[model samples]
Target: MRLVVDLNRCQGYAQCAFLAPDVFAMHGEEGLLYTPEADEAQREKLAQAAAACPVQAILVDAVDPPAEAVSGER
Candidate 1:
């Protein structure tokens, strides 16, 4: 999956870091550093991070079909 964090909108709240340490980190400057492509195993954590961001800066995109079908699909 692909994720993008809007640095301009981020307030360095660290919620993303707490929720998905593997994909999100707090830099020494108090800004955030994150991976755009997260492993499939980290999806849940990443989603949590996205939801936890107070500024709503985190954006997640799936690169491929999920292992499990989505609820709306057959």
Candidate 2:
């Protein structure tokens, strides 16, 4: 999965960080930082983080399947 946070829309509420510390974090006082690419195991936590964003700044997108997986190759 991929995570995208709009800095312009973010208000540094720290909700995302609270919900998903492994994927999101607050830098100092006015900044935010997060992982762009997340493991499949973190999908649920990532979703919770996105939903917890009061400013609706977080965007989560499914990563495209690998070429081998799509082609059914070994």
lDDT of 1 by residue, 1-74 (tens): 88898899999999999889999999986878898888989989998999889999998984575767658766
- Lowest lDDT sum, 10 consecutive residues, model 2, at 64-73
Q: Where is model 1 more than 4 Å wrong at Cα?
A: 62-74
lDDT tens digits, residue span 1-72, model 2 = 877899999999999999999999889997999999989899899899898889999988855644555665
For model 2, state the Cα shift of residue 62 in Å.
5.1
Show the colliding residue pairs in model 2: none
